[model samples]
Target: MQIKVDAEGDDAAAHDLYYWLRQDRELRRHAKADLTQAAEASDRMNAGEIINMFVSNGLAAASLLVNIVVAWRAARPSPQGTVTFDRDGTTVTVHDTSEETLRRVVDLLASAPPGGASGATDTGESSASSGSGNR
Candidate 1:
């Protein structure tokens, strides 16, 4: 599965997440993740950019990603904001990084599609962009 993570819709936040995920042992083991740069300056490292990840183990990989993201969100000084995880057709935007909230994300990603594949949501009272679309 391919995952695109955007942090608070901010490029810097996305880059922050990219570097953070890079350092995660479990995440590194599960997926090959990288930061997406501008079309013009692809050589230089883009600090504030989206993160793209490819995983072979589907839900397990997504779960590891969310776990790392939740920890990263908590470690921030303040204003945790939100992070959106888009995989397949499911979009989960998280405001509160609680266990329950993160679980919802995992559930959505793991959900069975009409056929045999598709996916998962957040625990936040702010329900705006989280969608369980067909994968």
Candidate 2:
């Protein structure tokens, strides 16, 4: 037979089944013997075969972990701070000022347009707009 897993709802059940299967004495003995033989054979294996085996096992384990994590994440609802935006008519605005400075800048930017310029004077030093030439 075949086993089907409803990974989201039956994760605990699947783990219990796995434990039960692994606990079978005959199966465990066979597995242990196979592992011992493989270890001995691995000593005789060429460097390439040894490296390939190690890489394959590592990749398989990593793939399994990644799949489980992705499934678990998918099964749960996303929390706040995970922002979603529309494909159209949605704009992201970023300001790199401190909270107080950001608030003031936002207020200033909101009140005036680019070239109209507000807040600081033109001393040839960088103002926010002139620095980027957004004006």
Candidate 3:
């Protein structure tokens, strides 16, 4: 005998009807086990998104903390001192940490054009143009 049934809404009622029709104990147990496994897999899938959100939020907080430290350092005034050193066998280096030097560097950058000192022209050529000819 063939029975035509449309099991759409009310899952509990549908499952009860299905159980009544399939009187075999082993079949019912197998069906229940499959449903349980599917439910667990679906739960894990939902939990993955929550875990990803937590990780992203933690990274964002760390990035914000780093930015705060950088801003604090930049706001502090530097000492007016100059240091000269030689390293790497034979290379000489001089570092000027004076306020005057910092001011000059800041002024130079402020006066520079948007793209840079070598501004771009309509023809896409650099203003501070230099080319190495075949020579």
**Which candidate number maximizes TM-score?**
1
Task: State how far residue 58 of model 3 sits from its true place (Å).
Answer: 33
Cα lDDT listed for each candidate: 0.60, 0.25, 0.24
**What tens digits encode model 2's per-residue C-alpha lDDT throughout 1-135?**
111122233324333333443444543432221111123322222221111011111333323322332333344342101101111122112112224423332333233223443222332211221122110
Q: Per-residue error at 8 for model 2, in Å?
A: 7.0
Q: Please say which candidate is ahead in lDDT: 1 or 2.
A: 1
**Residue 31, model 1, lDDT:** 83
**Which segments of candidate 1 are over 4 A away from where they belong?**
1-11, 37-48, 111-135
By lDDT, the better pick of 2 and 3 is 2
Judge candidate 1 at residue 64 and give its lDDT.
Answer: 81
Question: Quick one: best lDDT, which candidate?
Answer: 1
> Which of candidates 1 and 2 reaches a greater TM-score?
1
Clashes by residue pair, model 2? none
- Model 2 TM: 0.19
RMSD of 1: 8.0
Instruction: Please rank every candidate by lDDT, starting with the best.
Output: 1, 2, 3
Q: Write the per-residue lDDT of candidate 3 for residues 10-56, one digit (tens) a residue.
A: 22322333334244443333222111112232321222111000111
Q: List where candidate 2 sits over 4 angstroms from the true fold.
A: 1-4, 32-135
Q: How would you order the candidates by TM-score, starting with the best?
A: 1, 2, 3
RMSD of each: 8.0, 25.8, 32.1
